[model samples]
Target: MKIDQLATRACAPPGLHWPAPAAAAAEPAARQAGAALARQPGQAAEQALQFNRDASLQQVALDYLGRLEERAVGVLQTLAARRSASAESALQGARAGLERTLEQRAAGLGEVLDGQLRAGPATRARVQFEVAGLASLRAVQAAGAETLLFSVGPQAGGPLAVVLDEHLGPARLLRRFNASLGQAGVQVRVEADSRLLFEIDEAAWPALREHLAIRGEGRLFAATGWQVPPLREQSLQAELRQAPAGPVLRALGEQVLERIRAAREYFQQQQSQLRQQLGGETRAAAEKRRVALDFVERLNDAKTTAAGAPSHFQLNARAASVNRAIARSALTRRSVLGLLA
Candidate 1:
């Protein structure tokens, strides 16, 4: 029979019977003590013999139980250590995989930004033109009566007009013109020397230039220095050299970079959690092993005391009770492998 089964039978209630003892002659002193106790008086003699027999059997059962527990604990400790090591290795591998995925995503995001940056100019078109001495034009008629008329497209409505004030500077004139023409896709600004610079979308410039007219009610277009200039289309290469990626493309790149940063932080947190879990498992296993070994030591000590004092009925009964409690405790506790399952 297993040590556990024998221990359980040895610790049963006082009236329950068991099969014949297997190692009855192993301890002659215990047998002789039982024989001597049997010679006492009436039923008391039989009770003494039974107590001695029970003590000897309980001691033998506890000895076997202690040895079995020691061997089982050793096996369980080795298995637990191996499992912990394997789990740690798997955790490290998972972390490495996550890091690699994050790095790949980051690299892909960089490539996308670089590609967008390189292709920025091809998707945009701009046209620029400058008007000469247009800032100083004055009315050939009455002062403040001069008006500049601007129109876009052949079939558009009446032209918009800007009244020339004597005190109007290029900056104020440009702002007034933009306020009128901005919806038509034309933007005007003042450059150095009070010259007017006009920017128009290349797609709209052709139609705008075809039927566009700028008329001043004065010597504004005469040789007195005011003149309208032809539109100059900026080359794609020149635009590329001068401009960074457009706002929309830049925003997209920034979003990708932010996502990459978030992914990195998530992976780092996962790795930290894995490390903490591994450490906790290691500590818990160590504590469980310590408790199991300590219990085995106490059990061994009880067996030794029972063996040395066979006539001490109180000590024998205590050891048997301890054995039954340990059997019940062992049934309730699960090994590491069991918990994992």
Candidate 2:
């Protein structure tokens, strides 16, 4: 399902399921202000209770993610072959859980995102960037499609997500960047959805932030209260943020369109290269390549339901097919071993 729909499924509010005893607790919180001392004579015990409740919720959320992270990391570390898939799925679940918890906590403060934005339908693209890491030099192609990615780092403990390519809107980048920085303990005030100003409490390297801002556009979003590092102490941090489009970001969107058309052609070359690498003169590794390729195709076919729709049981069924494929692969391996014997 689409991320928004998935969140709704999980965090639909508790329906004011106030407990019989707790009902009285809400009664006096609003009136607690009226009881304020004419001569500084009273304490707002009710308001204090509310504050305590909110703090408890925050701790609960933190504890949940911490425990979940430990479990996911442990399972992923041990499950060698299937670990990547498990990790991807687990990452999505954890991030979604965090979003839902925050949504509930922030509802009173008007901080939650509208469940599913009623924007234009998604626009997509395919872009190529020249990536050079010494021996890793190559032109890498990536699909700039409308999908959400949860980015995390020390500064970005929370996930920020972008739904689509910037050609549709720069706001997407800003939102994702905001969430990412938000989780990092940065204070972000989006002047508007498109513009952001942030304050970082602490940073490992400050110059890199300035450098990125310059590339994005001068003061596209200002950083305040940051202590600049000396030239000698300054550091270069590689790949802090994923590739994003600038204000004048080339609408290589059309270029991306052209490249999507080139994909069938590109696929032929990729198929050949993969086959040759695996199906070397020494022995055929086509079996492994086949297993991996089938997975790649299935991933391409999955689609999410719209925002308000019920769960797409059909998609879940397709996901099960993936499990069946894995089982069949194991069975095939056993059969091959028997034949060899």
How do all models score by TM-score?
0.29, 0.18
Point to the candidate with the largest TM-score: 1
Per-residue CA lDDT of candidate 2, range 135-244, in tens? 11010002233333332343443435434343433445556545654554444333433233444422222423343221111122112422222122100011101212
lDDT, candidate 1, at 36:
39
Error of 1 at 133 (Å): 6.5
lDDT measured at residue 172 in model 1 versus the true structure, 0 to 100: 71
Candidate 1 Cα misplacement greater than 4 A, ranges: 1-124, 132-145, 222-229, 234-341
Error of 2 at 117 (Å): 26
Tell me the RMSD of model 2 versus the true structure. Answer: 32.0
Lowest lDDT sum, 10 consecutive residues, model 1, at: 113-122
Q: Please list the residue runs of candidate 2 whose C-alpha ends up more than 4 Å from where it truly belongs after superposition.
A: 1-44, 78-341
